[model samples]
Target chain A: MSAFRSLSLAMLKGLLRDRTASFFTLVFPLMFLLLFGALFQNDSVSRSHVLQFGEVAVLDEMPADQRRDLSEALNVEQVRDRDEALARVSDGDADAVVWQDEDGRIELRYSAADATRAGTVQGLMQSLVQSANLAETGQPPAFELASDQVEDKSIKPIQYLAPGLLGWAIAMGASFMSAFTLVNWRKKRILRRLWLAPISPGTVIGARIGVSLGMAFLQTALFLGVATIPFYGLRLTGFWWLAIPLVACGTLAFMSVGLVIGAWAKTDEAANAALQLVIMPMAFLSGSFFPLDSSPDWVRAISNAMPLKHLNEAVQGVLTRGEGWGAALPAMGGLLLFAAVLTAVAARLFRWDDT
Target chain B: MGPLNVSNAAGRPEPGATRGPTEALDAARPAPPRGPAPPRFGHGYHRQVTKNIPAIAVEGLRKRYGEVRAVDGVTFEVAHGEFYGILGPNGAGKTTTLELVEGLREPDEGSARLLGQPSWPRDPGLLRRIGVQLQASAFFEKLTAREQIHTFAALYGVSSRRADEMLETVGLTEKAGTRDDKLSGGQAQRLSIACALVHDPELVFLDEPTTGLDPQARRNLWDLLREINAQGRTVVLTTHYLDEAEILCDRVAIMDAGRILRVGAPSELIAELGVGNLEDVFLQLTGREYRE
Candidate 1:
């Protein structure tokens, strides 16, 4: 126990003293958060651009104020030539093309190249038609739609971004730290010296993992703490506290992944290559930066298989969607299973020295 | 005196001579006439009820990496408190042989017994009795020299005061707060040695501790090593420097191509081979210029 404690304390001190490691683990992801937060500062910012080439009655009949409000979410531009509008959408200049058929029915056409924007355009078109149909009756309906955010708090892009980015930060800190530490120790022959000590290898690894987990939790606190500042406008809600346990579960899983890479790679370059191959693709596809709802089915399918995807979803649900254990528990279960399997693989591949 | 007839050419008193069991073993066997001879291990000597065991004993130990025999069929012994050195050129299997004996790697064949206990299965009790310093110093990243030895001390359940005393013993008290990477090459080597001795183990192993140091730094480290062995601790070191082995070791093992060409006190090996020095001793054995 004393050995484990001293080793963990020493490692923690080492991490704190390593400026590059501290910057990459604790500060880099926050930079990403600030950048993404600033880019999507306004919640009402238009998501998709649509070109209306022909007279579409539903759009034409819309009130001026209502049209202005709709334009806030979707860029509706009127164009003269059908061919030109279709060409623009095909070339990815615009998201979709809107026209009316002889039957006076609204027709929306979109390109498959930008699947995420195409999905958004389709949803807006459906809602536009539905609202038009209801307004055509010109009567006060007995039942009306009443929509409000969960907990009645106005939601912003930062609120959604906070949880996803936090999950991402936790994954980065845990995995990279473990992988680099292992490879460096092996390269430096620290493992051999530790083997000569009275302490067991298990104790050394335990201390390392203990330090990694502590850094992980520190990242969680920093991410949430920074996001909750009034400037970022991230509001933590019901079951938001569940993120603590979820972060632990996710850190363990990613740390195992890192251990496997560290154990398999013989040098720093090889470990870097393996880390990039594993982490970069997962980050982009896991909906940490954007919603998977806009992604294509195949992309979403790949994202679904990634542990980071589940972590983002669970974190986003609790922090923004006002969800409880019902939503977070399944993700925790998946993360635990991921950690268990990867841990076994890490143990199988673990080597005390590069030789 | 305890049955392997290699004489001490330096005529120094037997290290740890006051130990009761060694005196008993000396009485049980007759001392042979002085001569230039390689040291040998009495096969069943340690199995006796007496505690007159050699600090290290290995017989026909071997380890192979693919087609290369890294430590092919080597055997040797070091008496208690003896300053021993394995001298060889690069890739001469010195490190591999040391590792096999240290219980850091399992031997492909044969056995290594440390202080009368089998080292292969890695007996934990034996670990407490031995210290190892690798060719490359291995420190916790970003640690200060003091913290490095302190953590090592903590692992062995040694006191922080003792760890600090070890720092002073290696003349590193002023550099105690210096980060390991910021230290000079010699300082790092001394810090590693301090860490190795922090627990005050009965046996210590150092591999190529002075390979890269300047002459001044190398001599400083030689003094520190001498002090360590003078404290009645068995010191086994491997080095490529022929003169270093001659200056520091009580007995040196000359190794080439994963085999020991000669093992005796430096003067004895030189006299027996009729060579002027160890460098000529190497040239006579391998018929090649000795290379670092």
Candidate 2:
């Protein structure tokens, strides 16, 4: 027990004292969050801008109060030329172009560059055309479609970014930290020295896990803390504390990946190459930077295989979807299983010395 | 178990060289009389075993890496309180033999018993009594000399005070606060040795501890090693330097091609082969010019 404590304290001190490691493990991921935050800062559903090419009867026939609400949700600007309006849409000057033809057929053209905005515009235009058709038929509609968010309507895209970025931060930090530390230690012969000690390998690995988990907690706090400030506008809801265990499980899974890399690679450069090959693709496919809902089926299928995706699922569920602990169980289970299997592989590949 | 009266009595150091500050301490300590050896391992008596047996006994140990016989059919014994050296060239299997004996690597054939307990399968109970310093100096990353040794001492449940004293013993007290990576090669080597000896185990294995040091640093380390052996600890060192093996080792095993060509005191082996020095002795035995 004392051995574990001393080794744990020592390992923590070593990690803290290493400036490059500290920067990569703690500061780099926060940079990712801040960058994503800035990129999505001005994007909001209530602030979508739409260009109106011609007069639309659906808008004219709407009740004044409802029309006011519609105007408030979308900024509709009159445009003279169709070509210029298409150019404006292409340049991202407008979210979409909406017009009604002489035959009373409404058309909506939106750019796919921003998938979230495109989806929102498609949904709004579909509903508007449906109502227009219903009014034209002069028959009472038997069914109406009503949609609501699981979270507050005021929640921003950055709110979702917070949890996904948090998952990414812990995953990147834990895996890179564990992999680099192991490879560095092996290169320096520290592992061989540890092997010479009276302590068991379990004690050494336990100390490492303890340190990685502590770092994960700190990362969670930092990510959420910076995100919840008014500018970033991240709001945590139902069973948000469950993110703690979820992040812990994610860290374990990623650390096992690092262990495998560290065990298999004989050099620092080799480990780094392996990490880039593994981590970067996982981050992109797992939707750490963006939502995967609009992604193709095959891409999403690959994303489902990534442990980071499950982490994002559980974290975003609690933070953005107002999900409870029960909603997080499946993802947490998947993460734990990934950690176990990779850890077994790591154990099989592990060598005390590089030779 | 094969030969209790194996022939190496002539390899013992001279009476004058054996006398030191530890002589009185050694006299005051009770010596275990030779007796019928304890039953070989697996009886669950690990700690506080009688030291009547040899410090290290290995018979016909072998390890092969692919086609290369790294340690092929090696056999030797180290007596209690003896300063033993495995002398060889770069690829002469010195490190492999040490690793096999240290239980860091499993031998493909034969056995190694350290302090009367099997070294294979890595008996954790025997670890407390053995210390190992590898050929490469490996320290905790970015740690000061003091923190490094203190952590090593803590692993053995030793006090921090003893750890600090060990740092001073290696002449590293002045650099106690210096980070290990920032220290000079000699300083790093000394720190590595200090970490190994912080617990003061009965048997210490050092593999090329002074391999890359400057002349002054090497001489200083030689004095330190002599002092460690003088304190009545059984020391096993592997070195490629003939002069280092000559000056520090009470008995030397001249190794070549993954085998021991000769084993005896440097003076005895040189005299028996009618050679002027250990370098000539190696040349005479291996039929090649010694190059390290």
Candidate 3:
């Protein structure tokens, strides 16, 4: 046990001292979170949409009270002229433009660049105008539509992106870090020297995996605390703490992949090339950058086979979807199985010497 | 040529003698002794008092790589506290034989025992009692020499202070804080030796410990190794330098074509071959042609 601890401490110190590895393991994932968080800052349900109101000749004839109520209900911003409102709508500075035509009918002009936002603005305007018409006629409506959303709050893009990013951080940190460090040590015959010692091979491999798992947990906490907690207001639900084990299994799985590459590759360059080939596709196809719901069936099929996909799903299920341990079992099981099988293969093929 | 008895001429010091570092190093700087003597085993009446337990025993050990036989039917025994050297030209299976005895490689046939324990089965406890230094060692690039030795010492359940003592023994105390990558080749070689002996193993295997070192560094290492042997430890070394073997080894084995052509004290091997030195005997046994 003392030997294992010493080896683990030595490996951790070596990794920390390597500036390039520190950047990738500790700093790069945070950079991703900050970049993506800022990019999707406005993708929330509570964001206010701008409605530019243009000067209309017929507005003077309508009752002042009715016009005031309509304007307030629409959240309208008064513009000097139609031309200005049209320019604002075209530039996407406003969600839509509202004007009263000569015939006294309200008309709206909106950009189709973002169809969802355009439709939302149009629906809001229609409801406000209908209420105005009822008030003008001085009639009490027979039935009123009182609507409430079933979900507590709308799902934000960051909610989905945070878990995926966390998964990506773990995959990259474990796989690339393991592959590069292992191959470099093998090239230097450091592994050979360690093997010549009294320490068991299992202890050496355990120390490496333990370090990677430690990094994985650090990445999970960092991405969650720095990005998810502040920006997305992440709420942990039933069995939320299961994320810790999920991350461990996921990290071990990817680290085993790295071990296989490290054992098979003859040089550092080859290991790096193989790592990139594995990591890039896994990150993308696993929904690290975007949702895979709209992707083609074959892409989804490929994503289903990826360990990162399961990790992202399990994390997002508990964090964003508020699911329980039962919901994350499949992903957790998959990750554990992957870790076991790949670790076995890596152990079978592992060689202390370069030859 | 006539048989020569040069053991006394080598001027080996008695065990446990106190000497300054400089004086101890100077003791190994004598000129190579010449002349030949008949093969001798367990010389003089001392043979009767010394126990006969061999530190290392190998019988019909063999290892093959595809079509090449790296170690073919090799056999030898190293008695306790003997400074033994395996000398051969390039590709003479010297390293393969050492690794087989060190438990780093599995032989295709036959057996090897170290300190009465079989080399196969690879018992970690057995490895704890042995120390090995490969020809090309790789250490953590960022760890200081002291830290590297301390780390290995911890593996063997040895005290961390042993690292300091080992460094002092190898004459590397001044460079203890230098990282392995920054050390000169000779300094790194000394560091490797220090790490190998950090656990105070009963048996030590050094594969070409002085290969790339300058003359002074080589002599210094020879002194260190002799001191280690004097402390009642077995030393098994493989080297290409004939003079190094002739000076340091109590018994030298000249190997060629995966077999030992001769095994005896340096002067006795010279006498047996009717040659001027071990180098001439090696050339005569293995041929003058180059091997890649």
Per DockQ, what order, best first? 1, 2, 3
Those runs of model 2 whose alpha carbons end farther than 4 Å from true positions after fitting are A52-73, A77-91, A99-116, A128-155, B1-50, B289-292
User: Which of the predicted structures, 1 or 3, would earn the higher TM-score when compared with the native?
Assistant: 3
lDDT of 2 by residue, A223-282 (tens): 989998998878778688999999999999999999999999988789889988998889
Model 1 Cα displacement at A270 (Å)? Answer: 3.2
Backbone clashes per model, in order? 0, 0, 4
lDDT, candidate 3, A175-257, per-residue tens = 88788777888788677677678788888878888888888888888887875466556566666677888888889888888
True contacts kept of 2: 0.70
Q: What TM-score should be assigned to candidate 1?
A: 0.81
- State each candidate's chain A TM-score: 0.78, 0.86, 0.73
- Model 1 C-alpha lDDT per residue in residues B1-292, reported as the tens digit of each score: 1111132432433322443322322332222222434344222222222347888888998899999998889989888877789987778898889999999899999899888888888777889988889989999999999899889999999989999988888778888899999999988998999898888888899999997898667766776786787677888999877767766666788887889878877667667777566667766876775555
Tens-digit per-residue lDDT, A91-178, candidate 1: 9898899999999888898999966567667777776776666566664351122111111223467866887788788888888888
Interface root-mean-square deviation for each candidate? 1.4, 1.5, 1.8
Candidate 2 local Cα displacement, residue B267, angstroms: 1.8
Ranking of predictions according to TM-score: 2, 3, 1
- Candidate 2, B124: how far from true, in Å? 2.2
lDDT (Cα atoms) of all candidates against the true structure = 0.79, 0.80, 0.76
